[model samples]
Target: MTVSIWQADGTQPVREVDFLVVGAGIAGCASALFASQAGRDVVVTDARDIALGASGRNAGFMITGLADYYHKGIEQFGHAAARELWALSIKTHDYWRAWAREAGGVHMDQRGSMLLAESLEEAKELELAARALNADGIEAIYHAADPLKRGYFAAVEQPWDGSVQPVELAQAVLRLSGAEFIANNEAYKVEQISAELVAVHTRKVIFHARYVMLCTNAYSFTLHPYFRGMVIPQRAQVMVTEPLPDSVIPVCGYSDYGYMYYRMTHDNRLLIGGGRHKFFEQEADTTDDRVTDGVQGYLDGYMRRFFPEVNARVDRRWAGTMGFSADGVPLVGTLPDSPRIGFAVGFTGHGLAFAAGTAERAVDHLLYGTHPGALWAGRLTR
Candidate 1:
């Protein structure tokens, strides 16, 4: 699509682009990069700076597999579908590794991850997951013995999965994407100009493109009501503690079905997040990114319980909004009403794990008219 602006002196300035991506988070940045690499004229815009949202505020674990446990995923979607989703996550992890290498190896650390089992029942579940994963040729080990000093009964270790510095990764993606970026440009409205064009209006400028991809995630509902109930927003609180003398957490870890996750940073600071379940009612359907006392208290309690040896104080605390679908899966496809506009949101809190592959699939649908076989395709409209 082509956009023309009439200057005060009656001169016309025109800009044409093939794809316009909204939101500068991981999904949006990845979309822009893929489109540009495919020789498409792409433009990316964000209301805030890159990685200021959930993309930056997450626990930094580059995990493989679904947000839901593998056993639960098999129960919900069956084995074939669950396997596909797991495969997709592994592909995303490989993509990040390749991208990081190409971008001078920034923000990526290949330290494997473990899912802690707080109870015997949870350990059985982990054992079931490990079996299913190994059956599918994915390596997984169930550690019946406690590997860490924490009081977890058992753990499921995925040696292939790792962690990344989320903010640094986002910055590297934006810098290496080679797409025109307009930061601090908040898109207020999106209009389908025609079957072949979409228009995005920000406070300062109106962007026109042949195709528009919305990667807004949590803020999607604000831009369009179509995603209101389908893609609900939830606030996730995170806190980083003062650097300790020794590393307490050897590997990235999560427990309680990923409701709580923590990892020791390279600088020996414990960066922990999660606990929305404690304040589910207040956190659900809200875009507020402020850390609430209730959730913060829960996180603090978790830290004290898990790392009692470290007499560290919370150095920083913040919150970020994450979109969640009825199912844990993300929404990825074109909007039913507007085929020219595509979206990839509702990743729950697994954006970092799913963003790259999700963006690539969405772009494939947009560019080549291919059908996306996303596990949640049934939940999302065309």
Candidate 2:
């Protein structure tokens, strides 16, 4: 979100608004939606247009939990918090589905998703995760053997989770938000002019607003100094193959502890992503959204190792940045220096899994001072 001296020169037009939401991605648009619903005059502005960021570039799995398995999540954040995050994921999916129904033209396939295990040890973990989820009345099937017969060991099938058109869903939410949307506007800096007014200096305009929600996600570090180390950027590489004559993957498939994922797109093309863990040094702490040969080569090898039967040529390749929090969960709270400037960032590559619900809590916490449990930013300090 860098602005050159030649671009703005600090002469941008000044605009007044009730609530200003930065980053027109899922979290930002969802923030705008919730804030407007709460009777605030909200405006959403972005460096890029709606759905042009990570929200549009995802594989669109409406997975009903964090990036970790249920048992792993329990280990990381404790049982209660893990359950709450799962519930949040479900609630977020519900919001997206409702928006899909309301807006139309969005495709949602209800075939569900499978968490495949690449090794025997991972298979055992999958079984444990399935049992943990089932104990909590979360219906997940444990398959002892690889269902796809793609040389994987085992899997946990979440029958309720589904794939979606993420970009379409984002657009639908934006339209339903009813907030004025300004595109190609990058917020270079933000300052609290007073207790009641926050000045958001952007490339195209400066906003004087009572409240501002920074849903900037991966690019959060650039807007304010406070975001440094709070939200780290991780780049994700993805590829889609030409439409196959037959579907290679029936459900959204994840394997290698989520280091690799493949899903059948709506048009019958196979979309593959991940491979970042192998090239961690290159992928971490970078906002550059360029496809790397190392990761893309990894995806190529992955496709060959698992789905060698698919001979269709790769049609497209691209990359996007994901915001990883200090903890792997989202960060929801207002800035200590400026309480009126709130934020919900750090989805940890689970933006589709957490954005809507996190945004909902962020809005509630910002406008009503309600505590956003599990993802409270105060926990980072403690």
Best by lDDT: 2
- Which residue pairs overlap in candidate 2's backbone? none
Model 2 lDDT on a 0 to 1 scale: 0.90
Rate residue 304 of model 1 by lDDT: 87
Model 2, 140: alpha-carbon shift in Å?
0.9
Residue pairs of candidate 1 with colliding backbone atoms: none
Per residue, candidate 1 scores C-alpha lDDT tens digits across 1-382 of 1122421222323346689999999989888888887788888888887888889887788888778778788899888878878878878888777877888747678788889987888888888888878777778888996788589988989877778888878777766788888887677778888878887776556667899899999888788888877788888898999988888877889888788999888787998888988778998888778988999999889988988877888899999888887678877777666778888787888887788888888888777767767544445453
| Predicted structure 2, TM vs. truth | 0.98
- How many pairs collide in each candidate, listed in order? 0, 0
Pick out the ten consecutive residues of candidate 1 with the lowest summed lDDT: 1-10
On residues 1-382, what C-alpha lDDT tens digit does candidate 2 reach at each position?
Answer: 7899899898878999999999989999899999999999999999989988889988887878887788889998999999999999999988888888998989987788899998899999899999999999989999999998889899989888888988888888888999999999899989888988999999999899999999999889888877799899999999999999988778899998888888999999999999999999999998888999999999999998998888889999999989999888999999877889999999988887899999999999989899999999999877
* Whole-model lDDT per candidate: 0.81, 0.90
